[model samples]
Target chain A: EPEVTQTPSHQVTQMGQEVILRCVPISNHLYFYWYRQILGQKVEFLVSFYNNEISEKSEIFDDQFSVERPDGSNFTLKIRSTKLEDSAMYFCASSKPTGGNTEAFFGQGTRLTVV
Target chain B: AQSVSQHNHHVILSEAASLELGCNYSYGGTVNLFWYVQYPGQHLQLLLKYFSGDPLVKGIKGFEAEFIKSKFSFNLRKPSVQWSDTAEYFCAVNPPNAGKSTFGDGTTLTVKP
Candidate 1:
């Protein structure tokens, strides 16, 4: 089965540094999303992307965060300045909107550690 | 203020035991419900989903979920679980046309062999 793939299984960055998490969604998927889970916390939605643009975002996806579909296959999430609270596992997901198969397929996740 | 809730934080069970995990959402109107599982060090995998039609939906590995619209609940159930069934389970809800899914806190299940 085809799955979403994320790069850099783990990353450690200093506070105030920038980080880009990359993902390659399934080839045929049109909708992409970014989510994060703090330790012992629920998974939180950050942003959703469709048609190469952001369709929706959450409060956590403030000015510091941005997402881009830089190429035909690559989707990335960039954080301008990392904070200690930004440490979490970031997940990338993609889904098809048609045929009543809207369930998203998730990547293994990139563990972002801000020190 | 849409939110998903999973009642149990952690559950311990022996092999062959029946299992049920409670989940509820605050969203009304047209919504899609789903149950996902994450085994150790694995990505989230869709176990089952309820969009329309039957209230009870069966999924891979003998897992099933019931979407009770009246109670705003979509609880996951399994009969005679095995040790391999140990994993973290999450309940999620999303609007029909939206891409973002509201996920519950997740329930960690530990099945003893």
Candidate 2:
């Protein structure tokens, strides 16, 4: 089965440095999303993208965070300056809606570590 | 704000034991409910979903969930579980038109052989 794929299974970055997480969603999927899970915490929604633009974002997705569909197959999340609290597992997901029912498929997730 | 609540944080069971995981959501509008499972070192995989249909829905691996609209609950159940069923389970809720989902804290299930 086709699945969403994320690059760099693990990444360690210095504080105040920039990091980019990439994802390639399923070819036919129309909606994409980014979610994060802090250690021992719930999975939090970051942003949702459709039609090459962000549809909705959460408070956690602040000014430092940005998402782009740089190409037809690539979706990326960029953080301008990483912080210690930014360490978490970031997941990329995609879904195709049918009659108002949308079931998202999640990627293996990229573990981001900020020091 | 919409939120999902999973009552159990961790559960231990023996093989062939019946299992039930409690999930409740706080959303006034029409919502879609889903259950996802994550095995060790694996991505989150969809186990089942409840949109608009019968209250009782069956999913993969002989698992089922009942969507009780009056109670705002969608509890997952299985008649018998195996050691392979050990994993983390999450419940999520989203509005019909919106793609954003709110997930629960997740429940860690360990099945002993």
Per-model TM against the reference:
0.93, 0.93
Candidate 1 per-residue C-alpha lDDT over A51-78 given as tens digits, one digit per residue, 9 for 90 to 100: 9799889999999999999889999999
Candidate 1 Cα deviation (angstroms), residue A14: 2.4
DockQ of each: 0.58, 0.63
Report how far off residue A74 is in candidate 1 (Å). 0.9
Cα error, candidate 1, residue B21 (Å): 0.6
lDDT of 2 by residue, B1-113 (tens): 99899999999999999999999999988899999998876668889999998989999999999999999999999999999999999999988766678999999999999
Cα lDDT of model 2 by residue, A1-115, tens digit = 8999999899999999999999999999999999998876778999999998899899999999999999899999999999999999999998887767877878899999999
- Record all residue pairs in model 2 with backbone atoms less than 3 Å apart, i.e. clashing: none
Docking class of 2: medium
Instruction: Give the per-residue lDDT of model 1 (tens digit) for B1-113.
Output: 68998999999999999999999999767788999998877678889998899999999999999999899999999998999999999999887766579999999999999
Q: Which ten residues in a row are the worst by lDDT in model 2 chain A?
A: A96-105
